[model samples]
Target chain A: MTADRGRNRRTAALLISGGVLLALFLVSLTLGRYPVPLWDVVRILWHRFWALFGLSTPVVWTDAMEIAVISVRLPRVVMACLVGCSLSAAGATFQGVFRNPMASPDILGASSGAAFGAALAILLGCSARFVTIFAFLGAILTVALVFLISARAPGLRVVNLILAGIMVGSLFSAGTSYLKLVADPANQLPAITYWLLGSLSGTRLASILPAAIPMALGLVPLLLLRWRLNLLSLGDSEARALGVNTDLLRAVLILCATLVTAASISVSGVIGWVGLVIPHLSRKLVGSDNRALLPCSMLTGAAFLLLVDDVSRNLLATEIPIGILTAVIGAPFFIYLLLRKEKTL
Target chain B: MKKTIALLLAAMMLIALVGCTKTPNAPDAAGTRSFTDSVGRTVEVPNEITKVAISGPLAQIVVFALCPDRLVGIAQKWDKTAERFLATEYYQLPELGQLYGGKGEMNLETLLSSGAQVVIDVGEPKGSIREDLDALSEQTGIPFVHITATIGTMGEAYQKLGELLNMPEEAEALATYCDAQYARITEIAERVDKANLLYITGDKGLNVIARDSYHAEIIDLLGNNLAVVDSPSSKGTGNEVDMESLLLWDPDVILFAPDSVYASVGSDPLWSELKAIRNGTYYEVPMGPYNWMGFPPSVQRILGMLWMAKLLYPDAADYDLYAEAAAYFRLFYHCELSEADYDALVRNSVGKQ
Candidate 1:
């Protein structure tokens, strides 16, 4: 009876979180630098939704309004959802796999690699699209390098992998710093700085699908394998004793998480706190159980980032970098949640 | 505990009160004369002024134009493109870094060893100008003074710069020349109807110099700059907006930064949706040594205004662009403008890049 109640409560929590995410998504789509009325935001989304199904309604809204909501705002809203969901889910997966409370999505040098790649691209005066491509390549390469080094090391596999990650990540960070030093101060330096401090201000409908497809690829497997993440957390010896290939499972999970992280960061740049903080916040709300935690983290992160991006685009005429807002806003909220948890204790 | 606390509080108040009354301005020494600067800070400057240091690139440009020989060091190293336009001695000065924003701070060791008598800061006054200059002056033991140099008032800046540098006749000639050019630009600006224009920058051509920004002084003066955002970015990259916003803005004339998507914007299908792109009204800003439009906002923009004027309204400009370019190159850059160099500089600017 107690187990059934626990399951029911978890289901209830998921439904509520999903509802909140949906509501935030709509809110985010409405809010932007361009003033589109609330009603028009609905009308544009509604008209575009039916148009996708070949039901062309009578056009009442202006092209600018349609373009603002559908072309400009929709992609940004979607990018936020993709980045937030990927980071949170990946972060949770890393924590569970490593059995480390401090592990984040960039635990394997993905973010630093992305940063170095982005800085180099900016230094080369590459277009925004190429910058994203270079960043994605950088992330994948660094993580692969980490795996290669860790594979041959003579320590505990997870420990060696983490140490290798630290070394590689630091080297990439140093590379990013060097690029910044050498970049043209007039234009390239600011572009690189803005890229380092993540933003969704550059998101376009055309760029969205490329990033989203890879993010979906990584996220779908993460959801399917979340039940097994719990087994890995119970120690590799115990999981192996129970007849699971712990090494293979760990490798697949890490790759999936890395892919999602790289794709999200390449598009949105390096948004920090969502990956590191959201899963912990989700764990507080749900539990440490990966089955409940992963979905919860994804939903909460999507909502959190969507909310932050809304404020980022709408709060000022200039874009306050999304990464900055995440920490500035998230730290206080996290502290509040922790305090509430402490009070309950 | 209350007695000890009261004693500590009393001591702290005493320190604060003493600090408030302590005048940072030192009384005039024998060799220095008091000069009232733009921000109304009376600074004791050397009477026989020779070596001058600049605070940043903006100051470097104006100072170089006025007294190129006196500058102790360049704030930023001139690019290789400047080699043909500027003498090696001027462009190859030891870089003193900068006092304010950019990659590096002012190298004190370099400045001290270079034997600069006074450091002069010119450009728009940031909020903490007086305090910052005074603090630098105190720290370096070299008098620091600020002279306000705006896009509209650099002519007057030349006169003030002349006073500080003790070169009134040369300052007068340059000042009069600047005043004439600015007045002509303003007259030409008033003669034409403002076109809906967008100045786009960044490698992607997604950023816009918003209306009322310092960078958009010429754009706003000449045309209706449409990229009005809530908080305009002060950085040279401007505000980063997507292509959709560009389409929504739908400017009649689009000016691309020299470093931006001028070379490839024509090929993109998404960009081709914009009326400016479709109409082929987009053009790159001219650059040789520096962007004619204000990035660091130096005296070179005197030519930028004329180019923009002629580009926007040919009839009202009422002056030969090549004639103006040749004269500006001779006076400011100290390089002769061959017809070919002028053509090359403005080749893409006149039409599509």
Candidate 2:
């Protein structure tokens, strides 16, 4: 009876958070340096939405308002949500699979590898498209290299994979440092450093749309197998005894997790704490049944990051890097959560 | 098999050592001459320096202005835009990279092969810089000289560099020009009411040159920099501000960096709300060979001063901007700016009449 009550409460919490996220997204569209009235913002969005399907509505607002709402702000808000959702989801999965509370999406060296690729591309004077492509490739390749090394050396223990990931992550981080060292200090070095810090300032619909495909492809499989993730969280021998093909399940999870992580970092640069903190925050609200935890973390992360990004761009005359604000806000909130209640996974 | 492999490696190591030690054949260094550098370090340089390498871009600009012929290796590769202003001979100089501003892949082998007698660095020194430079000098067997050059002290720095390079006539002329420009600006600064200005950079128009930053020296001297924060940061980019703060500040004029939001800012609805933008007092800083505004905060800022003075108060500081720009280009860049070139450079840059 109590278990039923808990499930009911979790469902309620999810619905509330989801509603909050949607409300925040709508509010964000109205807020910017250019003040578009609430009604005007709604009208502009409604007109654009209908216009997409070969329909025309009366154009009430100016082209500038339409551009600001549709072009400038929409992509940034969407990218923030997608990145937040992917990072949090990946973080939860990695922690569940590894049976370690501390594992983030970048446990497999994805963030570091992506950073190296982006830095190298910038150093070579490549365009933004090439930088994103290189970042994605760097992340996927680093994880692949990690899996290859761990498989070759010895038993496929989770610890072995984690250790290999650390080694590979360090190597790519060093490569990024070298690129920063060689870049033109006036233009390229600052570009690389700012990129590493992560901002959504230059986001466009063109960049956001391409990255969404990979994120969805990675996310769907995880959502489907979320129930089975509970079984995998058990020790390997125990999971196998319980009729779970631990090896196959682990491989699939790692692949999906890596894809989402690489794609997220590729678009947003290295936004750190959402993946690490959001899962913990979700777990505190809803107990760790991968079924409930995964979706809850996703919604929470999306809202959390959207709010942080809004503050980051709006709080000052200069847009603070989203990564810096995430750590600053997340780290303190995480500590408060820790002090409020001590729970072991 | 292992023994054979070890032997091969040893032989390769020996060859590499020999290759590195074979110094380029140049006129034998005249008996060493000792001179005190700006940082109070007395270092022995070759008495007759026929060739030289710069440690970074700041040094490259200063050295290039005085003696382009003597520069054996450039700190950076010249792009096509830079090449347009520079002489054809300077276009092909070997790129040795740099050791400062986080761009630290100074190719020692290339510097050595270029046959440069000494490496010259011109900038503010920081955090055991003397020791660091000394160590680098010892490692490369090339004497490194550090010369301090702030906006205020650039004239003196030029004079000192001239004495070191034995190009008193060229250095004196450049130094005199710098001093005269500085004096001219300071004189006019006293007479005119300073305009409230904010210098912004970055693609999103968030980065601000805060009051009293090293990069804001010219802005401070010429105008009232309104982006005042309690503690200013000197990182890769300038300090960041939000639209709310910018709206509150409402600067009378806004100067955009060359690679910043200057292109798209006019179309930006929020940016267009700014008094500077609405009044069309916003201007993109000009760049040909280098940014006229001191991005690196070098001697090039003298031109920025003249340009800003005219841009701010056209009536009070009445000088033929084109004539001054042409003279500056000829003197510092060693390129003649034709009327067409000047028009192209200043196109869409002047405030809307």
Candidate 3:
């Protein structure tokens, strides 16, 4: 009877999560400058999925609507989903690894490092693509340096790691400040400022692929270790007694989280607030059991980001950067979460 | 593995050769150059500077005219916006961020990475910034050059920069053009009474130049009786004046920049009651390449003055105004004047009071 109940709960969770994602996807697709009817959107999605397989079936207006939906809106929505999922997953993993729920991706100096790379690239005439590449490289380098500097053994001490990240992040921030000071007032400064704010436009397939491949590689191992993550969350010594290789596990998770965070940042620039807030929300919804929490976090994050990005792009004739919009919405939500969590605790 | 080794060796040799070609030791204008800059400073600008970085928009324009490929960097802002306004073909050149403003504050690592031989700053040096500039120049082994921001300084700056880059003739012609325009404007203004002029933007005092400011110097050349508004120290904090002050200083003729409250007075309820609006003596400012009349301090503002003169005193001269407009655009902006770009420049040279 207990087994049956457990199966039923899992099934229900899966169904609800899938339903939320699908509903949010539909809403995102429909809410744009050129609003398509429900039937047209369904047809458009149908045509896009089929067309990819070299199938030649054309219902009237399917081609244009498909282009509008898939080419124009789909990449942005998909990117938001991917970035959101990765960031939240990384955040959850980091918080668990560190035994600190307050942890987020940028806390380890990754965003600051990426911002420095991007600022340098702009100063040197490199375009958005190179900016992403350099930023990812900087993030990877920063994480490596943080790990190296903070490691008491082969793995990191949580407090030491945080301290090293703060040190490195501040150094990079100083570099960025220097770049801003010397930049031309008439032209380059505004562009850098806008880029730093983080727009999701001008992201081509090429830019997306570099980030996506690394994320996929990182996420696979993570999904496999989801059960282990729950055990790991019960403090490091408890995790070790339960037959987990705690040091190896910590390193792997940190590397994976860094990969996911860096990949997302490369394509999307530095989007803040989502990673910090979504995992907490996931925890609230399904409790802090990593098994349910990880997947739920991903789902909630994907849906929330898509909803935010949709508002960002469609609310005005000129699209506000997703980073700014996310903060505007999420900061208040996060404060609310803290207030609610405080009452419960 | 052997082939890879050989290829790497070849690449290293090529890089060395490229490095050597960058430092051509050209002599300065005095012939027996003392290897010293102005302010009695000793600095080493490698003979032929292959890699250079510029700080200002006008400075970048000057450098581009001299050597298109030599610029290694600029302030980030130049790389984004103003470079787009340059003829489309020149957009593909390399840039470095504004490593320094008028004073040189560059990343030594970034400068070395780009292999810049000299640094060019395009404005007057601010306090303490000059010291930083000197320090950076010494540390980076890149000679720093400063260009002034005067009426005829663009030509001189360009020519000197061109000479440094082995493109003197182009720079000379540009300088001569600027000199002639300056001379002509001076000649024209000397004949008119410099007192009766009223400047406002739409219904507000967005900006005003008094007889003491640099803006006043340019307006003074227009040969008009300057009617000045008493701008308080608290108003617009030295950039603009209040609308109330503008109404109080109502004069015979009102000239306005684009989108100003002064221009809107003919239609504005508060301003329609003003004497200038009632007499139909309002004018809309001209728009030209780089916002000539809108921001009346660019070299293009000379064209604004000629247009203004034609409108205010139509009986004053028999100048071929369109020809002059066409010539100025052709010479400075390096484009054949479209009738629209020209008309837009002079159309509402000034608007309703």
Candidate 4:
């Protein structure tokens, strides 16, 4: 009876957060430095919906209003939700696979490698699109290197992976610093620093739409395999006795998580704290079961980032990089979570 | 006893004479004159300024233009493109680094050792500039002077620079040119129909110079700047903006910064939706040794003003573009600009013919 009650509560938490996320998305679409009437936002979206089905409607709203709603706010809000959800879900998956609460999506050097690649692109004076592409490739390459070293080494696979990740991550970080040292201090160095701090101010529909494909590819697998994540969270020997292929499952799960992480960071820049703090926050809301924790983290993260991004772009006319807002908000909320008296995860 | 007294007296006289002898590269106390800088700080500057150092790129360009031979070390090295219009010897001057920018601080050791008499800071004065320069001067034992030069004040800045450098005639010529050009731009700006203008920058062309920002001085003067935001960024990168903002601002005319999305925006489906791009009103800012607009916000901006005025109001600004550009190149860069040179410079900006 208790287990059933626990399940019901978890389901309710999921629905509540999911509903909150949808509400936040709608609200975020209406907010920007450029003011559009809420009615116009709704009208423009409705008109576009019908237009997609080969219907022409009279446009009551000005062209600027339509463009602001469809072109600017919609893509930015959507990208924020996508990035936030991916990072948090990836973080939860990493923690479960490693059975370490401290593990984050970038534990395997994804963020550092992406940062290094972006610095190199900036140094070379590559365009924004190339910089995004380079960062994504850099992340994938770093994770692949970690796996290669772990698989070849004559030691415990998990331990080897962790150690290898640290070593590779450091190497990429050093490379990024060197690029910064050589970058044109007037322009390129600041560009690299801004990218490191992260921002969604530059998101275009064209850029985010292509990136969504890879994010979806990674996110779907993690959702389908989340139940197995519970078994994997158990000790390796115990999981083996239960007939789960611990090695193969761990590899597949990690690859998907890295993919999600890489895609999230490549477009948005290196946003920290969300992957680390949001999963823990999710654990507090829902019980520690992977089934409840992963989805809850995803829904909560989407809402959390959307709210922060809205503040980032609107708090000042000049963009305060979204990464900065996350750290400032994420750090304080984490302190409150730590002080609370509760059953620990 | 008399010999001992005579010897002691001679030795004392010798020591006094040695102290009076001038130190190499040291300013004679008598040679320095009290000169009031832009911020009202009275500085003792050398009378016959033979060797000058720059605190940043702004000063480097202004000083190099006024008295190229007197420059001891350039604050920043000119890019390879500078070789086309600038003399090889001038462009290859010792790079002593900048004082206030993100890249490298002014190397005091280098400036002092190079035997430069004074280090000049140019352009608009920051809030603490007087104190900053004062502190730097006190720390390094090198005298520093700042000359305030906004788009409207270039003539005064040039005059102040001339007096400090002791080249009154050359300074007067440049100053007169500046004053005349300012009047012409004012005339053009007054007569021209206001076109809603947006200055787009960055690799992705997602950045904009907000209205009234330092980088947009020329744009604001020549056109109706439309990128007004709550807080304008002081940085050269301007503010990061999205395409939606551009569409909403709906500027009829657009200026793309060099090395931005100008080369690709023509083919991009999303960019083509913009009124400026679709109407062919967007043009890349002309760049060579330096951007023709106001990134440095220095002497080049005078040229940038003329070029911008011409682009905005061709009828009121009906003076020959090539003739004006040739005169500027000859005076500032000391390089003769042939018809081919003039054509090549504006090729990407104005497009062929």
Candidate 5:
């Protein structure tokens, strides 16, 4: 009876979080430098939705207003939501698979590798598309290299993988530093520095579309296997005794997590703390059942990043890098969580 | 064993003697004159200042204007395209890199070897900057002098530099030109309604020069800077902004930095929605030997002032931009702009609409 009550409460929490995410998304669409009245925003969105289904409607607002809402603001908000969802899900998976509370989405050097690739592309004067492609390739290659190295090592698979990630991450970071050193100080160096700090300032529908496919492909599998993930989080010996193929499941989870992380980083540079902090915050509310925890993390992360992005883009005329804002907000919240847990103990 | 130890000691002594005697020859300091520089440091500079090394790009530009011949080394090598606009003597000079802006790979060995008597830094000083420069001066034994110059104070800076270089006549000519141009702009600025202007920079042109930023001093004087953030960022790249904010500001005129999206912004659908672009008041800042606008914000900005004045109010500021540009190139860069060169530099850039 108590188990039934617990499940009911978890379901209620998940529904509530999802509702909050939807509300934030709608609020984000309405809020921007361009002051579109809420009614106008709703009308514009309603007209566009009908147009997508081959229906015609009279346009009431100016073309600039339409473009500002549909083209400029919509894509960035969507990208934020997508990135937030992917990072949070990946972070939860990594923490569960590793049986470590501290593991983030970049546990296997994906963020550093993606950063190096983007910097290199900018240094070479590649176009925006090539930069994203190179970043994606760099991430996958680094993860593959880490896996290969760790597989060769004999003992303590999880620890070996983490150590390998550190080695590979450091090497790529050093490479990025070298590129920054040689980049032209006037133009190229500033470009590289700003890109590294991470912003969604220049995102377009075209840029966001390419990353969306991979992210969706990665997310579906994660959602389907979430129940199995809970069992895998148990000790390997116990999970093996329970007839769970821990090795195969772990491999699949890692691959899905990498795909999501790399694709997200390619579109939105390395936004830290979301992937690391959001999952813990979700676990606090939903308890550690992966079925409940994973979905809750995804919703909470989307809402958190959306709110932060609104602040980043609208706090002043100048946009603050979203990574800096997340760290500023996340670090303090994390400390608060720790203090609260100690009080409970 | 005793013989080997004695031989080793003799070799070490010989090596030490050779090292001690191989120090690069310093210019004789017998006729040094102590002068209070812009930063109020009493630096003992050479009485007949000949060879000089720049501490960074700003210093390089200022020194280049006054005495291009005396520059022992440049902070960075000029672009090949800029070679035609510069003197041939400066083409072969070593690139000594720089000391500031986080690009610090200053080649001390090359600086010393090039026979530079002193290092000159131009611009406002930051925290503990005096101590830092003093330490560098003491370590390298090359007297360092700092001269602070803004858009308003170029004339005084030139006079000080002229006195130091013993070329008061040349300095007076440049200084007079700068003061007159600045005064004219200030007067015109007060009379006219300042055009709401936005300066966009960076690869994507999303970065904005917020109001009251050091980089946008020229913009501030000429127009009403539209990017009015609460706390203005001091970074060279300025602050980043989104398209929504840009649409909200809806500036009257937009100036694109040389390295920004000047080439593609005209056709960009979202950018075309801007009122400035729609009205054709947007322009790409002219670039040649150096950017005429605010890169380094040196004496070159005199030309920027003249160009902007003409571009903004064609009837009010009646001076021919071509003639002014030709004169600036000849005086500052020591290269005459031919009819073709002048056309190419300002082509589709200034007053195009």
Candidate 6:
């Protein structure tokens, strides 16, 4: 009866998440700078349904629709999904390893480090793709430093790790500030600022691929070890007693989380809220079982991001930064979390 | 605990008082301080303009044009070639950090350490900037002047700059020359029906100027019919029209720059679609120290307009293009163009790219 109850909850999560993604996909396809009719979108989707199975369609309207979907909306939606899932997965990994709910992808100074790297690349007048590579390197370097500095005892102390991250984050932030200082007032500085504000506007398929591969690799391992994450959540000693090598597990988890977080940040800029809120929502839905929570968080994060990105494109004549839109929606939810914390305390 | 609080409060009050104190003008040998500048304005200048700063390229350009000796700082580089060219001047002149979108967030300590005397800004006047400049003036006794661009109101703007710089005669000469050029361009432009002119560049992708822009106004002054007069977004200032919009608004006589339109469409793909391209009416605009054919109606632009009018309507004018170009430079820029320089300006066309 208990097993059946768990199965029912998982099925509900799957169905709800699947429905949200489908709705978001439709919204993304129809709503943009040039809005298309919902009926036309539906017609294209139905006609091109066979094309998905590698069969050619005679309808030319379907071809145009396909190009719009594949060329424009598809990459954007895929980017949103990849970024959202990666951030949430990394967030959950961080929260578990740190044994603190407040811990996020940025807690280890990944975002600031990436921002500094991006600024450096922009200042040098290199391609935007070079900025992504620099961001990844910065994130890894920051996390590595955080790990090295905080490795004082048998296991990593949560407070020490956070302090180290803050210090490193500030140092990297100073680097970003320095680049902004030296950058050309007319062109480079504004470009750097806009890039840092976190938008997915100027991404191409080639630029997206590097970030996607590492995130995919990191997420698979995270999903497979989701049950072990639940074990780790039951305090370090308890997790250790359950035949889990806590130190080794933590090392692997940190590496995966950093890689995935770095991958997402390098591609789409630093998008917040998904990492912090999605895991908490997943826990509320699936009763803190990492097995169910991880997949649920991934889906919810993807759907949430796609919806926000859809709003970003259509709501304003100019493409509004997805990061700004997410924060506007997420801040209220975060306030609720804080209020709930007050009641619990 | 009460004593400690009192001590902290006292320290805070002391700091606040220090901040509130008026910056003292240094006394002269006679012990009477007469705070005045070369402009003859009785304005106080601090003993030091330490933390000397500038905002945009225009700010640096104004300093270079007016008082190159007074400049203690500069901003970041854009083009690598431009950077190499400007490096000697840049190394000699310290940069006061990057100005964020002309929003000068000066590193106060770095600026102060440098012992800068004045901060010169050249761009659109911002509110917070005025406040900061006022505060810095009160705090450090450094004078800040916003030099206006001599684009729209050329003669008046140049005179105002002269009044600020204490160069009244040079200013009058500049203003007179600018006025003559403006009148000449308008008189010549009046004779032609507004021809469909597309000002595109080969360097950047699909970014074109509209009639509302400062650049467009110059083209309008030259008496040309703008292809895409309507812009996409009427946001902050200028509108960046997209590629699809360009296709919809077909132009007659295309005057494209080298760097802007050269990337995407080489050898003119729209040969059949465009009247200008098909008839070979498309002409590459001349680019030198200043891009002539690209409209934004500066003092240097008169030369470009003359060249463009001569190229597009050779029968319309019997004036010598070379002599006109040289005269315009001498009259406005206050520098004589050498024979080679005049040839370079004339030969430097959009077709060269």
Stretches of model 5 off by over 4 angstroms after superposition: A342-345, B1-353
Q: How much lDDT does candidate 4 score?
A: 0.81
For residue B287, give model 6's deviation from the true position in Å. Answer: 26
Candidates in order, TM-scores: namely 0.54, 0.54, 0.54, 0.54, 0.54, 0.51
Model 5 chain A weakest lDDT span, ten residues long: A55-64
lDDT of 3 at B12: 56
Candidate 1 structure lDDT: 0.82
Which residue pairs come into collision in candidate 2? A316-B241, A316-B242, A317-B241, A317-B242, A318-B240, A318-B241, A318-B242
Worst lDDT window (10 residues) for model 5 chain B? B100-109
* Interface RMSD, prediction 5: 29.5
Per-residue lDDT of B32-150 in model 3, one digit per residue for the tens? 22233333355555555567776555566555545655666553333332342456555554434443221112223344445565667654433333554564554444567665545
lDDT of 1 by residue, B34-75 (tens): 898999999888888888988777888888888888887887
Tell me chain A's TM-score in each of the predictions: 0.97, 0.98, 0.91, 0.97, 0.97, 0.90
- Return the number of clashes found in candidate 1: 2
Please list the residue runs of candidate 6 whose C-alpha ends up more than 4 Å from where it truly belongs after superposition: A1-7, A42-55, A62-67, A152-156, A338-345, B1-353
Highest lDDT against the true fold, candidate: 1
Stretches of candidate 4 off by over 4 Å are A343-345, B1-353
Task: List model 2 lDDT by residue over B1-353, tens digit each.
Answer: 99996777667556545543443443355467887889888888877777998977778887788888899878777645677777788877777767632124453434554667788998876434575566556545677888888777778888988878777888899888888889989888888899999988888889887898757778888999998987664533577778999999999899988888887878889988899888888998877677788766677888889888988888878899999999988987788988888877776567555
- In model 2, how large is the Cα lDDT of residue B170? 83
Q: Residue B316 in model 1: shift from native, Å? A: 32
Comparing to the true complex, what docking class would candidate 2 get? incorrect
Q: Candidate 1 or 6, higher TM-score?
A: 1
Candidate 2 lDDT tens digits, A257-281: 9999999999888999999999999
State the weakest 10-residue window (summed lDDT) of model 1 chain B. Answer: B100-109
TM-score of chain B alone in model 3: 0.70
Evaluate all candidate structures by whole-model CA lDDT and list the values in order.
Answer: 0.82, 0.81, 0.64, 0.81, 0.81, 0.64
Q: Tens digit of lDDT per residue, candidate 5, span A34-62?
A: 66688878988987887686554455564
For every model shown, the clashing-pair count is 2, 7, 43, 1, 0, 19
